[model samples]
Target: MERIITVRAEINLFDGSRSGKTTGYKSGIRPNHFFEGQTSSIAGDIQFEGQDELALGGKCFAIVRFLYPEWFPPVVPGITWRLHEGLRHVGDGRVLEVHSGR
Candidate 1:
């Protein structure tokens, strides 16, 4: 069986000039994951640490759980990615740790 993949990542939400989200993101929100140099995105859920919401243009560490773990490339520390709502880029992230998940 394929083990669910999860990671600890450092996320940065972009501001309006970058065509990012107008507001902010809350924990447990599912967003598409676009790995570096990749045009397409994989499905995932991000839960921010501590705060209930991460404001636009804010940076924080989050736990990311990939919904379809098989669709992604090998995740490792220092590899970067982006978070999207549909095709719109909203945030950026860098993998800090990878582990098995439920």
Candidate 2:
């Protein structure tokens, strides 16, 4: 039998305009989550993590430990503000959508 679905998905793409274009990477499988920013402060769904200084807020800490120091991209700075398309609550595992300042 064919699997039944109730909701339709939207197509999100990343335009070259820089700052998240009020959109996302086009025509790709939307990742369950993406890197919010690079800083001591993190806010998003937790992965393999533990308690630390940046972990005080009870939310996911920014994943700065795993990235290269020189890889700091302009579009993605050290700190970013999380974005919510709908209802968002602390510790809800929502990703911070920092306005991509081009």
Candidate 3:
């Protein structure tokens, strides 16, 4: 079975221009093992709930892919995952919240 998890992530797109270009590093959510050979990005709107207090770059609805049932690990609510920087996992704000996609 295929499972797609939706997460409300606080993504920090490096220090660069937001001019409709894919610039800067996406500092959040290490891609699940299922999306090994495929390219993906979190697409969602910018949330401003706690912008001032947190000073986060922006918030968005990131789609986390778990192509198979076994691909997903036991997750705890409100636990943040580090972002992928090339082969390394760095940074923070990759909060995951699983939804029932039945």
Candidate 4:
């Protein structure tokens, strides 16, 4: 199955606001920053395996991987894929933007 670049997901830091039953900001997902050496938290590395491509019910497309919680419902189809070096039309990229949350 051939494929191409279709989507990209940016996994960024998040802070939450606690209320009644739910405890999160509608803005984005909460990221664990510091180590209190306590409470339930998500701390791990995300690595991409296999090729960076996706298909829509058999149509070729690109897949980008986002660090979405497994418990989260499948909001959409396909995935976030990673691009390789010297592979094709893709370039010697540069840092477009970055936010160092301190």
> Which candidate achieves the best TM-score against the true structure?
1
Candidate order (lDDT): 1, 3, 2, 4
Residue-pair clashes, model 2: 12
Candidate 1 lDDT over residue span 1-102, tens digit each: 244578999999898778545788889888888888666777788888898899888999988887645545677789998788887988889989987652
TM-score of each: 0.85, 0.21, 0.38, 0.16
Which of candidates 1 and 3 is the stronger one according to TM-score?
1
Residue 100, candidate 2: how far off, in angstroms?
A: 17
> Which candidate leads in lDDT?
1
Task: Please give the lDDT score for candidate 1.
Answer: 0.81
Off by over 4 Å in 3: 12-71
Q: Backbone clashes in each candidate structure, one number apiece? A: 0, 12, 0, 9
For candidate 4, the 10 contiguous residues with the lowest summed lDDT are: 88-97
Candidate 3 residue-pair clash tally: 0
Q: Would you list the rank order by TM-score, best first?
A: 1, 3, 2, 4
Which lDDT tens digits does candidate 3 get at residues 1-102? 545544454444322242232433342324323122334433222232333222224344444443334334543456555444454433344555655342
**What does the lDDT read for residue 73 in candidate 3?**
53
